[model samples]
Target: MQLFIGNINGQFGELEAEETQHFSRVLRGKLGQEIYLTDGKGTLAKGVVTEIHNKSIQLELSEIQENFEQRPYFLHIAIAPTKNIDRIEYFLEKATEIGIDEITFLKSFHSERKNINLERCQKIVNAAVKQSLKAYVPKLNDLTKFTDFVAQDFSETKLIAHCEEDFERKNFKEILQPNENYLILIGPEGDFSLDEIKLAEENGFQGISLGHQRFRTETAALNAVFGLDWAN
Candidate 1:
């Protein structure tokens, strides 16, 4: 079922402007019509359209499912944005649907795109969550430089998904422990530079190979998300 995200304040299930438009114009929702709302924190609320104004709508929540489809562990991926915006957008949508917890854009040595539209990407994430009927919305971090990102503290098993064969790497499947929090680093189209790889390793990130076949930055990130889910 198509779902909408509601504001989380003193009262729950407050429809935002776009959602109000979607319900009032596109869906032609009637008064007292049953609708679903999500708080994007693993809570799903079933409500009915109670008030419909020219540019607004209010829902009276009747039921709620807390911890809806919660995953065993958190998976956060820091990836270099591809040159093409569509690829990053696709990754955001598909990964959210597949249950990614957090996404961080990296500006590595070989990164083609240094920036992205945060607001637009967020909308894509929200739309994907609604489309997939998920209550949790993945967090999208601002674009960060590779050096600064690596220095940040992460308690989980940190991994750098690189393609170079010079260094010995662990197979992703074998290293992943069930229900363990993870923070993976995926390089861009040109992959991480040798210095970048060395820096990551020095910062507690183990080299991890996605597979024998090379994958794009977005593909590797998306694969990591699914791989973690599969491992759990």
Candidate 2:
């Protein structure tokens, strides 16, 4: 089914300028063609085209379905932005496709890149949601200090992914529980500092390992996402 996106209240529908042009001039959808519209907040509506114009496409809702499954519990991933922005963008695309609740870019001591293009990241997320046929849009947070992010009152299950020796570590899949909210910390290329891990532990974040092999920033983030899906 072709899914279009709109705001939460379903007041105004949105289509990219290109999409509007294509639907009007290229595909030429008729007035009665059925289409699916989503608010990106778990609300899906079955709509029929009412008008196809150059600037906009109008639809009349016939039926609506609300996804009330409680979102499979929240999965919030905090990671350092990669030096090469493409890798982080790729991770965001795949993570959204696989179903993550929120993403935060942490400013770490060992982080090489300190800045992120929010606009570019949002575009990637939007495209991924359309490709994955998902109803909810994952929340994207601005870059924040590692210490500050670690100190927040988060979900019940909080984990820090670090490659340290002292702490007793388990694979994320082993630690995660189904139907419970989770927050994971993924570090940058140089990984988290020993002191940072200690601070996180002090703040109630459990240290967990993705696996034996060393992974890049993006890989680690995606691994955590996989772990969450497995647990769910």
Candidate 3:
């Protein structure tokens, strides 16, 4: 079953403008065709095409499927955007496939890049969700300053990956607990500055290390995602 994304109960069925075009012209879907639709917020709806217009595709609700339940734990990563946008985009794609909950681009003191292409990153995530057949889409946050990003109220297990000495660092796998929300920080090419690391620690983010070997910004972020203990 092909799953299309739309705002659930947005007025004209579950189909949006782009979805409508794809249904009519791209997929050549006709009236009475069965298709699965998701609101991206967890609700799944079953519908059959009722009206196909140039600008809109309408569907008659056959059934309102069950809402999706995410993993007991949530994974939120705040990474410094890479100079190569493709790398960050790749991270978004793979992270979504692996079941990340939220992503935020951060501007660190030594960050090589300070801007993010949010629109393009979203498209990548959307494609990944469809490819992975996931019910819930990850939330993408706008680029934020390092200080501002760390100041958010997150009651989960928070960690920051950095390469500074004098601070005891634990492996992400060792520190993460199952069924608990987690927030991780990954720095840019130049990595996080000493002051930035201190600020994060003061703000409740525990210092951690992915491994001894150094990694790129995107690689470290993905490693953190994969290393999370999601069991239980």
Score candidate 3 by TM-score against the native. Answer: 0.91
Q: What is the TM-score of each candidate against the true structure?
A: 0.94, 0.87, 0.91
Tell me how candidate 2 scores on lDDT: 0.81
Candidates' C-alpha lDDT: 0.87, 0.81, 0.82
lDDT by residue for model 1 (1-232), tens: 4699876442446787888888888988889888788888988888877788876678777667889989999989898899999999999998998988899999999988988899999999999999999999899999999999999998888999898899779999878898899899999999999999999999999999998786877888878888887888
Ten-residue region with minimum lDDT total, candidate 3: 7-16
Models sorted by TM-score, best on top: 1, 3, 2
- In terms of lDDT, the best-performing candidate is 1
Candidate 3, residues 1-232, lDDT tens digits: the string is: 7878776673236577777877788888999898877777776777787877888777766567554656667899999999988899999999988878899889889988878878888889988877776778899998999999898898778899988877878887676678778889999898899999989999988999988888888999888777663453
RMSD of each: 1.7, 2.7, 2.1
Best by TM-score, which number? 1
